[model samples]
Target: MEFSGNPALYRRIAIAVTLYINGGAFIIFALIKYLLHGDTWVLGWKPVLVTLLFSLWFGRAMYRWMMRLDAQYGRGSGWVLESVRVKLPELRPRQPR
Candidate 1:
């Protein structure tokens, strides 16, 4: 659950969070629009396309920001990068006959 130092993990988490947040925001906006305009925009392609574009732009921005912060503070601190070592199978090099 803790992705503190791993840039890959952090990026993935950031993307997921951004998607959820943007989706929720769009849903709320749609609800408000529905209440005000009575579904007029809901059936329109323009609104849907605009919302999709906005969400993609916002998500990309958020992802970049999160990665920058992780690199600057999280990984730089040497704490988030702390990880446990796991034992793995040992391999021996083959000798030339």
Candidate 2:
């Protein structure tokens, strides 16, 4: 399948995948912590805060890295963009008010 060559669509897919990865990791970590220590706050709020920060950082980093790779190598199969194309609404730049 031919892609529309839309960077916006690529970006959206990258972001969505990154979020799912980070979210799943966070949930697993929370579950493990709760099971082992009987509470998610076993280490207090600092660890939770750190986990949240790390997840966000990791997700953003992954998205940027993937986007860079796609830009450099081009989409080989175009499967990723094709699968996500219909899910994402058309994006347009907003005019200044």
Q: Which candidate is the best by lDDT?
A: 1
lDDT string, candidate 1, 1-97, tens digits: 3447666776677678877887777778888888887876664888778777887787777766776665655444454555799999899999999
Q: What's the CA error at residue 15 for candidate 1, in Å? A: 2.4
Q: Per-residue lDDT of 1-97 in model 2, one digit per residue for the tens?
A: 4445566776787668766877777778777888877884744778768767877787667656666565645464353543444567789999999
> What TM-score does candidate 1 get on C-alpha atoms?
0.54
Candidate 2 Cα outliers beyond 4 Å, as residue runs: 1-4, 42-44, 72-97
Q: What alpha-carbon RMSD in Å does predicted model 2 have with respect to the real structure?
A: 15.7
TM-score of each: 0.54, 0.49
lDDT of 1: 0.72
